[model samples]
Target: MKNLLVTGYRMNELNIFDQKNKAIVYIKRAIAGRLAPLAEEGLEWVLTPGQFGVDLWACETVIDLKRERFPQLKLGIVTAYANPEEKWKEDKQNYYRNILKDADYYGAVSNRPYEGAWQFKARDELLFRKTDGILLFYDEEMGEASPKFVKERALKLADEEGYRYIAIGADEVQSMADEERLSSFD
Candidate 1:
């Protein structure tokens, strides 16, 4: 019953448009496909930060996987602070809330409102401390609040803690989307 953590770029950073981006759909499918093997290997819980893009997509994928295959699998949404979605747009906030409602467990790393960068770092540390493995979706080229930064920090912590980690990069995601498109024509 191993626990895993998921981290990655937000929707804006990934340029995902309204959850309809073909690339995003392919990426989610690819991530879900990857998780199947891990679920078979012993994974039972997935912890997501409930952020947009990769984190949310991963959470949704885990939920679907749980329903279809891994009946024992569970999802946990960890927020950086109380009302972490306070600043998000209404639609985004609603989506986040819906996911949180469906999660098996939900908690805020900081009980208070978000203060500064330290809160985010603390949340990341907490997530790293709680999970046995990590799944990172990152692109080194996206330098604005890059997922690569978080992935690197998580990987460093995983190495220190002797936890397993897997990373899927932008190029690999593109390749997957291309393959999906090609296969669809068959």
Candidate 2:
């Protein structure tokens, strides 16, 4: 896929209140593991809805990939509405600002401040229309949060148009953590 939309749990949804949380390392590793091969196969762009957990981390992973391996990869952050970081703490806002500064493209789907849930639905439709595929960090049992909407929409689109969709489940993330632990002893 040329363009892929990546999204998942928000910080609050995942109960990760800070960037220094140890789980972030494994989460990012999972994203990078899946993304590297896609990049090798001509994935040029990674896009996110800027939900600020898995979404922002996915963009960060793309940046890491560009630095460490695939320089051809680009990052995009399109939020559902404007000023996505307005309510966030200063540190989180700064973190998001840095990502936006480094992004190849950054903007909002609605271009206005939050009005209602319809804005997010508009974002989902816009993402489905723009990207060729998706890399979602979601699982059915624990994915009753915002990611569910995106996942559901992506699955329907995949059924209709064969749109490529990859979901990273909790078990896969746990396995990556286990693999890292074992490799550290080697």
Q: Pick the candidate with the highest TM-score.
A: 2
Predicted structure 1, TM vs. truth: 0.91
The Cα local distance difference test for each model comes to 0.83, 0.89
Write out the backbone clash pairs for model 2: none
Name the runs in model 1 displaced over 4 angstroms: 141-144
Clashing pairs in 1: none
- Please give the distance, in angstroms, between residue 150's alpha carbon in candidate 2 and its true position after superposition: 1.2
Worst lDDT run of 10 residues, candidate 1, spans 139-148
Write the residue-wise lDDT of candidate 1 on 1-186 in tens digits: 399898788888876769777777777887887789989998888998888888999988888898899988899989888998888889988888888877999998889998888878888888888898788887667565657677777768767877877887778888887887899999
User: For residues 55-81, what per-residue lDDT tens digits would candidate 2 score against the true structure?
Assistant: 989889999999999989999888889
TM-score of model 2 vs. true structure: 0.95
